[model samples]
Target: MPLANLLTSLSALPESGSRDAYLRFLKSAGDAALRRSGGPEHVTGSCFVFSPEFDRVLLCFHRKGQFWVQFGGHIESEDASVAEAAQREAREESGISDLVLLSPGIMDLDRHDLHAGFSCSAHWDVGFAAATAPDVEVSVSDESEDVRWFPINEMPIQVPAGFGARLERVRHAAMSQSGTQIG
Candidate 1:
């Protein structure tokens, strides 16, 4: 029942080819979507954090991949919802506070080949759109090499394989849904 609301929220999204697939997977797997015990694919969450004015976006240089990425990671057992997991991961990874969720449903869904030591063979990533205050400071966690904001135009050059496209989708969602917007 923990994932019931998340499944409901995801059900509200205007499904695309990829989102439809994620929904199908969730329908079939249920709570196993968030569990990693013996499975190769598991749920992960992340937020595309925007600056107050919505121009610059926050990013972290992952210690593992050594490239810039939106703040997010594996959803833990304590995470009751994918949205909460995404907000928590963004706050923890970016050191940004008072981040507001722009949408309650899944903003984006992506499947990637994850070779990270912490994850299984693949990641079924659920993303949320969030906005942070302008004056907030960022702390670089041990999992990251650095934390900083980048212009949308210059943000994609070094983003790892799956991130660039996902960020773009979140940016579009934010702009459409958040009134002002950030890319």
Candidate 2:
């Protein structure tokens, strides 16, 4: 089947009521365009990042696929807000006990190519804040291979699509709240 058609079909499926639902949502959404590419549904995920300093963010290196992504996921139920879920998922996955969910609203949705024959939908990412030193130990979870902090200007190349811009917006919001200038 064409990738886009496959993704549409996958998205139309009933939610699996598992962690996999978020993954499915991402795979379907990201690959919606791939129906034209003649591919299949791929894995879905949620990702987030933490700003530990004024100009740095924490990121995870996913073991499963070895890609760098923010902390987020698929919508689990109709009850919880996507942002709430994103924060909870990030805390669980990254073991960052001191993080705070920074909010006005969800920042953005992003889509990207996935493995095998599938594409993914917008990863519903929610950004957060932390005040720990840059080298704080990150207790890795099964979902991630490794975790580390990166300076804003020195982020990894594979940092999820749209993340840089979103982080910039988040920083601006924070700066505004603090009555400071961001340049």
Candidate 3:
């Protein structure tokens, strides 16, 4: 049932290479892709958490990747939909439970190769955007060494490949979807 929800969500996204690829993966891998043990690639959910003002983005210094990145992880059986998975990850990793999804549909999709230390060779990441209240405190989860908010213009150097562009896309989507000014 959750996989069906994911499929519906992905299907609703506008046509794009990333969307196409995710559809293909789901068609071929079925529910297996939702689990980490699903071959070498699996679906994961992540969120670019923005401040109430939308000028700052929350990032975690991933312990394994050693880079500042958005909060996310593998989909679990408990997740009812991909967006819910993203929200769950954001809440767990950022320690901010009041995050609101910026869009009803996913904002971005990224398939990236993993480092050697990871169990999976790649992650087909479903990306979303969320906003948190001003002055909410963040506590770093066990997956990260640090969790902090950074200005949208001054992101940290140690980040995943293509993270800057990804953030820009997600930011635009978040702003437009939420009817917030793209300041």
Query: Once superposed on the true structure, which residue ranges of model 2 sit more than 4 Å away at CA?
Result: 1-48, 117-136, 161-163, 177-180
Q: On residues 90-130, what C-alpha lDDT tens digit does candidate 2 reach at each position?
A: 67667877655654243333445455422442222324333
The candidate 1 region of ten consecutive residues with least summed lDDT is 174-183
lDDT of 1 by residue, 12-91 (tens): 87867877888788888778888776388877888888875667788888887677887888778888888888888888
My TM-score estimates for the predictions, one after another, are 0.88, 0.59, 0.95
Candidate 2 local distance difference test against the native: 0.53
**What is the clash tally of candidate 3?**
0
Please name the candidate that would achieve the greatest lDDT relative to the true structure: 3
Candidate 3 runs further than 4 Å off: none
| Candidate 1 backbone overlaps, count | 0
| Model 2's TM-score against the true structure | 0.59
Which wins on TM-score, candidate 1 or candidate 2?
1
For all candidates, the clash counts are 0, 24, 0
